[model samples]
Target: MKIHNFSSGPSILPKEVLQKASEAVVNFNNSGLSLIEISHRDPAFVEVLNAARSLTLELLDLKDKGYSVLFLQGGASMEFVRIATNLLNKKAGYINTGNWANNAQMEASFIGEVQEIASSKDRNYSYIPKSIHIPQDLDYVHITSNNTIYGTQYSEFPTVDVPLVCDMSSDLFSRVLDFSKFDLIYACAQKNAGTSGVNLVVIKNDILGKIEREIPNIMNYSKHIEKESMYNTPAVFSVYVSYLTLNWIKDKGGIAAMERRNRAKAHLMYSEIDRNSLFYGTAQQQDRSIMNAVFYLNEPRLTTLFDDWCIKNSIYGIKGHRTVGGYRASMYNALPIESVQHLVGVMQHFEESI
Candidate 1:
């Protein structure tokens, strides 16, 4: 039996997607070669790359004007630095919602001036900060669409006159979004998209020509955009896997369908959390994440006992981050409704056992 993996990253992918990926690993497109061994420059891999890029745009409903998608290596972490180096000239505004958002601010500070417009640090990142005051003169405003660690998400993004850059590492393609609002969006293809190794970047074409700073060709978005994401050898296997995942998304009725399923899963778990006497939902109710539902027990000892119970039941990766000792169930796109139901059963059983 396959274990229900709730890991935040390298997270669960659809079983069909995994099976298809396994076949490709042995004989990609019946090319008589493993996808891992194939040349990135080969026509077969080139088709994979183009399809991946095209499907990403199609799924996001992005048009040609001002937006270009690039499949690059070096996860979203690298883009934290690259975005600052390429875009931040005088000043940039950052919203510190969680660890990843703070990391982006720290990286931007290394390159240039980065102002923290708003932060939820005081609340232990349990809720998204509202009333962010972006500086009028800042070059760009950066926001993390979802806080993976804290289980808080922005239901609606703030309005900014300047260019908007978003680190959508956790929630990319999880729902229908206004891609045109963002001047640049970057995501590590591990959570909802695909496995690790490849980073998907979507940037506005017009914003490419505005960078006056002298940076390496690799750091420049324009370079990758111009070369069709082939400025250098890409993460071919990850890209191909991502393409398969995108196809899976399309087959399952795209983002709208996934959004409905995600909401249903979130409701099942969160409703249990609210109703249970032993457990308490961690994140604010209004800003709770559909991807990661975090909660804690009233009795600290119950936390350990509950974790052990989950493990014995073959439900894994529900332990919360060390920074915040609790439980987090990462219900990514591929986590089945059955798994969420199983978890809810565990929660109910634990209450009865106590």
Candidate 2:
């Protein structure tokens, strides 16, 4: 049976990307050496790394004057601490949207004075907060561009005079973004970029030398920028694969094409949920996530049955986050329309059978 994958991270990737990666793993670029065994310093590997970094900037339409892109080892979790240590001087403002935002805020607190300017915690993050007040004296304002687990996303970023730092792990390349608006944007590659192992950081050039805190060389963004993200050996294989994925995105017409596909996939699932009498969506209609759709059967008893039915039908990873238990269909960039149609059919079948 051809299975459909809906896992949020280490999630689905383009079929062509996977096939190309598999070939490279055995004989990279016809070098007759597996990509895993190639030296990071090798010309082949360096080309891959440089291409990945360059393509990232090109896709985001970023100019060289103000921005620097770094492919780092630690995931976005590490960036939470790094951002605070590097950017937060006296105080920082953060919008607490969901679990990941709260986690990022927690890490920032350990480094300096941090304040939750606005939060959706009261409503269990079902909706995005309308306003965030950034204090003029604060160093930077942080926002999670998309809430992966809570099924909420910011349609428009909060406007603040201060620098804006965003953790865009889940929705980094899914839509077109104004790269200039943010001082910093970091994301773990597992979601839309590639598999787990590498994280991408795009930071403003001006923020590099302004920090007062004694940040370690490894944690410092400036050091990574200076070294060209070759500070350590770097995740060579992951970076290579990420390069392939970015190339795939470019071949598919860049972010504009991706936005149309993503919007269509989300509309397909949400339309079914709205029309279906036996199922209900969990997140607020206006703030519903395009990446992850959270919904559940009207009859509580059918939850387990529905989950089992999905598994039996070779539909995978539709289970919701444990904290917000229900059904979550993570329609990532690489997930085909057919997979989503299968899921919708499953939902319709369950509704009829029940």
TM-score of each: 0.98, 0.98
The Cα error of candidate 1 at residue 150, in Å, is 0.6
lDDT (0-100) at residue 153 of candidate 2?
A: 91
* Model 2: per-residue Cα lDDT over 1-354, one tens digit each: 999999988899998989989998899989899988978889988888888989999999996757889999889999999899898888998899999999999999999999999999998898999866667898999999888788899988899998899999999999987878998999999989988899999998897678777878999889999999999999877887789899999999998898899999999999999989988987889898899998877888887888788999899888888898888889989999899899889888978888
For each candidate, the alpha-carbon lDDT, in order, equals 0.90, 0.89
TM-score of 1: 0.98
Residue 84, candidate 2: alpha-carbon lDDT: 92
Candidate 1 residue runs with Cα over 4 Å from true position: none
Q: Cα lDDT for residue 222, model 1?
A: 83
Count steric clashes of candidate 1: 2
For model 1, where is the 10-residue window of minimal lDDT? 204-213
Question: What shift in Å separates residue 42 of candidate 1 from its native position after superposition?
Answer: 1.0
